[model samples]
Target: MKKHMKLFSFLLALTVTASSAGCSLSGKKNSSTSSSVLSEDDEGNEGSADGAKADEKKTDGDIRPQDDFYGYVNYATLKDAEIPYGQYGTSVFMDESDESPSEKIVKEIGKSDKKYAPGTNEQLIHDIYAQAISYKDDGTAEKEIMANCDRILNAGNISELMSVYGDLTLNYGSPSIFQFEVMHDYKDSSRYAMYLYPMQSFLGTSLESIHDEISKCEAPNNIARDMFRIQGDDYDTADEKGRQMVYIGMDIANNTDFEGANDMGHLLALEKTSFEEFDSIFSNLDVSLIDVFCADAKSRADGLYVIDRGQCEKINELFTDENLDKWKAYIYSTYISSMGYFIPDSSEILSDYFPKSKEAEDDQAASVVLNYLSKQVSEIYTERYYTPELDKGIHDMFDEIIGSYRELIANADWLSADTRKALRKKLDGIKLITAPEPHKVNAKDAKLVGSSLYESDKALTRKVMDDKLELLSSPMDRMKAMMLSTDVNAQYLPCNTINVTVAIMQPPMFDPKGDHAANLGGLGTVMGHEIGHAFDSNCINFSPEGKYDPSWLGEEDKKILDERADVLTDYYSKYTIMEVFHVDGKLTNGENYADLSGVECVTNILDDKEELKKLFESYAKTWCSLSVDSSGIERLKTDEHSPEKIRVNAVLASNKKFNEVYDIKEGDGMYVAPEERVSRW
Candidate 1:
């Protein structure tokens, strides 16, 4: 799957808009007009001037004077306009005010008395519960719910369950596992039917089965299960508990086939035990010493043991003498104090795993040690350096684009005075946040010890769980913090806040010095697209305060909006992917609205400046880069946004300016009959 596909249609609250102070770039004395702008000396041969004139005749009667320049473009270029050539510069930095049309719409919606349907996921749960409740027999609902829960809980053997849970806990941690429970009020008729709850609640009921499975499994580091057993056994030595723990860790580390001494080496050093060791072990049939050594070592210290060769090879691959020396000093200062999770604390044992060289306490040796330590520390560290720069650039770009929109708003002749006033009100409520909040996850804040991998793992897990619980309990606050974090890709809150941080402000989206058209087509379109989301059917009912109300428009107005949306849906449905038809009209309605409206808004903004319109079209060409991926083709079937070709073609078709600039004829692919064209603000 494409990494960014998930983000393709999603709304991000992270967008920053232009200032509300009525800022105008056009008012700047330094800004130049198209007539004075420089131009390339490329030939401009009109192939079918007669055909264009004939086509123009058809729409002449219906064309309003104001609409004549709706998509006009001035091909002139300017010498000092900061136009980029070839691949533009990588980093762009700017500071600007935040103003946006989407924010205004959201704010106006907030004041309205529109009702909101539950989120899709929430609605699914509600529907399931309602179905369960509809049965006349009270036991029927309860029984069905229990049956489904039991099936999920008991689908595999106890050992399999343990393995699955252990893997899940290790990788995703408990919060993700919490997604498997069933909760029901049984009292509230509205919501008492069937709802999913956290999975932790079921662990208690199946603890015995789980333990039995763990006992049967030969692998090591069923980490949580092992810890649970040790705790339950009261740290008993009589049962050889320490040995069992060591065996578990070894089993986990050595399961794969790779060149390492044992499992410990495999897990920590990313190596596997040599085939010779396996052969020798099978022939000797004496594994007691290995088991005892592992167990006793684990009791006092947490050591990630692997064949020395594995660690040696990895060290060679990653470090050089100079780099190693710096790392050694850093590691001793940072991680040497905390070694309980992985290696035994006894000096003799510690020296066996990590020996201190007395010779010069030399930088070379220190470097080696430091290199190893850095690798260990990096596992938990999370910091992105480029986020701030990207955040600043995106915000500046958004501000400029939104400022252009204000001009369009001022010039819109189709909207009624009352509607325009409401539109302005909506624009006023848009909120912008630049970077991710400081409170977001950071490795520096997490206290991790390299000596004991187990201890470090447990500590990290606990920290993450605590964090998740906090987020779940106070979702709004979490959302706020996320918006502030510069590392977050993008976010859009039901609230009017549009947040665009540094994480997603890079690459194909927004390049600081790329062709003006490409940059705008990428991030600029994305910004406008998200803002348009605020006016989707579901969002339209909500007021700026994030409350569901329907006060913004009357029933007749809503019907008109719905009709317009239907037209969009029907039009997009004609597009095909992988031989499958377009997305369900209702399912994709929101994204469709955003696409259409976003294009209209951005295009209108560009129309205010003929030269800018040309620049914008040039930028849009980049978005048309095609891919051969079948899945991408298949996406057209269920994706709300049309293919790039269709998006550009359809939007441009309705653009009178585009027609004039391109000299489109009556039968052109992008031609839209005047009466058939639809317009909505």
Candidate 2:
């Protein structure tokens, strides 16, 4: 199996528009462009539901534009839109135009007879496409993965067990028993440090959930049974193996340290120390599968960091001959999952294990090539579909928004001088990078061979790991990308960078020919939201250059900031989804505040009445969705984002420009009275 990276993005890591916003899925909208700005009520009844419904709208929908902005603009599109087969929800992010360069590139490369020099990107692109078509799922990849599993089971002693785990890490580019990586030091961005991460859980991540889910073990058991059954084991034997792995997973989960090892809260919870401290902390624990600590491999450099002593303690307790078979079964379980879920469709080779919808069936081949060499594919996409005008226009708008933030901070009477300085520093340091920078990867640079897709993927993993490890000795390259240069996503990485990729820079989210109001409302708001992460409740602890520094703000200033943030938490908590679940204010504090601040930032740039209408509509339209109501209910309960309706209504309601432009009065559903408003920056 190819190695998977553990990502770390701060509170507003995944932008709501840049993504499907984690199940707040979207659908296509064909809204009428006619004017729908709110007209004054004729009758004396204000704030009445009847009055709201009577408001004029450009398109037909039951919602009043002022009351439910998201619904008014997107209701028709979402109501009529059908969720495609096998998709849990619908999203605008999923709407790829027919002319998208990714699929075109795949077909073009696959059909090309032109050859390039060895180790060239052109060669890799051509080879990757060929391999995607040549892939054989005939259990070969599974057996290859299982060989590592067998090594774990056959180990006679701790040394041999440790040896296999090391080979898995450094040689085959697989997840190690003790995962470690050399990356930039968060406290000081100039140098890199080796970080020893915590044990990953199989099912549940919470300690209490471990006792609940693992105790039942139904999910993991089914996974094991289904995998075994697909691999030709009898149902009875498969069922037994399933139960055994669950029991093993149960033991592993019990030992997992799950207090604060997540993307949302790592900076506040994780500790850093010297290499000697790391060694001393674990010396008595009897187990430390240190990074690249395989028996025969040599580990260079001395900088090392550990999450805490608890990690080594857990590993020591778990590594024993008595638990060897349990370890093998647990590891083998991952192979079953990979082979079953991601196995290639085969007319003769790898069996297509499950049935898929026609939509997915059509995307299978191109999807394979896209997933196989995503970064390179991103390069191809930019080369074929690069729009310089839109790119420059968006960047110019981003700069204006950053200036607005600066002006807002400088004028904030409540903020102290030190807070203002730190914020301004962060604004200055925020760098924008176009992912898979157009033509940066020369056609003759990166290389891959004419092997199976499985092997080619493994080789690609090694290339990524090679670059990651090389960074330990190299200077911090702020321009180097940390997140996937995905086709339709934007991310705020801890490296103090806002990465905007290829496809997302195009239609729906942005347009070169579109008016400034619409473009700013759509993509500018998204960019501001990412910048807002730098000063949110959680991320404000980090320094200007993205280094963690909780003490940067004065005690008095922090207290005032907390009070301001409290208003958002309380405000959003009152909102409900599916008419049953209430949004968790504290859980969504960072994101809600980001939404409010993001809109405020973008709204600061333009003042025309007509422009404001277009801006607000574009903002609402960007999040238009037809998600399964059940999914929205769950996301409202657990997701950091407010549901789509609340995301539009609540966010716009707080904006002074929105209220002024829409003529939202005291009793209007979209009006938040002056005293009750929350302005968090």
Candidate 3:
């Protein structure tokens, strides 16, 4: 049986009302935190339960609320929760307790019999769903896929194959040897810029994250061989080609800083050069890389923001006649592996050909087809599942959190007058965007027309690329800028706005009929968690104007802020998973800081002890998770956020008010001394 709160007066206490906060939690300081987790989801970005998708989920042993708030409140839920297949973990926010939101959306759309008009959203939505579920293994699908691959990679020389890299990238969703993106400039975050990085290899890039070193180097060869076989190459030829692609891919992976990509300093450490100068990085070749950087982006190229100069130059060494077969094999392997789905029985072929390679690939997702119909699916979701009242309630909660944040910053003792004013300014400017963004979903002329899913997807890919390129010349349009509706996440965009994604507005995260405390603990705290990020060690530097500045904090203020955050870093650093690896507090401090402030911001607005109890339970429920022994161990070694239990316990430990409500004493596992507490915001 589930345990009850300490006192019988708990019911009476729940009746007491409390004020609300106008703040929220947030993402990584420089990038985005996974949106699905209570704070950071990791398994293919599922609300991260961390590592091994448990064959058998494990909840914590019996623990008193005063001793272990996270365990005490979440243990019951975790005991019964099941981790879905292919997902690393599950939580109250996005669980397997009911039908998957994505599957539900797909099924609802697929069930429609009425034919939608071509170019219309309804028609596009239906077609996307139908095509995704159409697992055509017929010879025609494979032929079309092979024909496309051969067309793109059928060049005689290295330069020829390299020339249409843009075409391959823009028209087809093939993973390239190099990744190109139109994004906010490193120095000038205000305007869009074209960024390029040497393609990190399929080996060690996904399925497994490469840390300090790369292991199982030959794994790529096996994968490439399997890919070639499934794509119709003979074993002897496949063996030879697999070896060749691994050779080329290894050269790229060696020089690429995959680990550094996670660091803010490394991310902002961009190398800019003109088109010609950038092209020169590919020495000894007549090829103009700028020509292959995609066409629509050519005119809008502010400058090439090369992320890995060494890797670019290093890969250039491979662009030679001597390595023509190597280049061809590498190109073929990547294209086939990524675009192989066009072939009917692609999944089955891969399973028989190379089952392990299929594990982490995006094409295996059940609602993978829905990605093509994002705008349409979102529109449908809003029409059927959302309400104006829900929208208003979310907006109202955000408003309350914002009010709470204003007071938190206004009263922060360590912050100087200047910093306080600036923080408040950012808080004041923070906007809340709910589901079905304020802007329209689709373009008037945008239409997908193709006999096959592959052909139709080609059109969609080009449209998406064109849309991204158009942003290069345009200022950040916050209205048009939103996360996918199907993603169960809430993000505080670096632009100082909070996104209460439609997917997160469901149960365990938020409910329209939930009592004030439940809402406060669920969605209210999420908003506050995002808003509270402004006070994190790194986010404190985000300008009200929406740019990241390393030097935003004045020297004196910076020192004070670091001193304050150091407490959090030290407190969290003490935590370990399996007692083998410790949490990287320095790497995770920004998120930890946000988690603490997220709670502090929400708790400050509510005063009733009974209501506070409910709010606290709701908050912990969001992070409820079951896992195997190896679960948090891998995450602690790799991820930037604290483990889920740490995210809950550490923050709750620092929550004096919560401690008081539960009558937690110093001996309690959940208690921290007053001086040791670190609620900086």
Top-TM-score candidate index: 3
* Candidate 2 to truth, TM: 0.81
Instruction: Summarize candidate 3's per-residue lDDT along 128-239 as a digit string, tens digits.
Output: 6666655455576667667766765577777777775556766777777667777666455566778775465564344133323445446777777776776677888888
Estimated TM-score for each candidate: 0.46, 0.81, 0.83
Q: List model 1 lDDT by residue over 1-681, tens digit each.
A: 011111232210010111112110011111332111111111232222233344233221221111222111111111122312331111112101221222222223323354433322122222222222221222432243233323324433323333333333433232221231111111211111112121211112222222335543322223223332322433333124333333322332233232222121132232223333422332322232222211222232222223333322332232233333222222211122123113322334334435544452332222322222222211111123234556567767777656655555556655556655555555556666654333333334324332233333445454444444333233243134233222324544456556665434556566676655556655676677676666676566655555445567566666766788887666555433322334444556676666666666656545444554544454343332222234344444344455443454445555565566655544333445666554545
Query: What Cα-based lDDT does every candidate model obtain?
Result: 0.37, 0.62, 0.64
lDDT order, best first, reads 3, 2, 1
Model 3 vs. true fold: TM = 0.83
Window of ten residues with lowest summed lDDT in model 2: 5-14
Sliding window of 10 residues with minimal summed lDDT for model 3: 9-18
User: Native-vs-model 3 lDDT?
Assistant: 0.64
Candidate 2 local distance difference test against the native: 0.62
Give the Cα error of residue 186 in candidate 2, in Å. Answer: 3.3
Candidate number with the higher lDDT (1 or 2) = 2
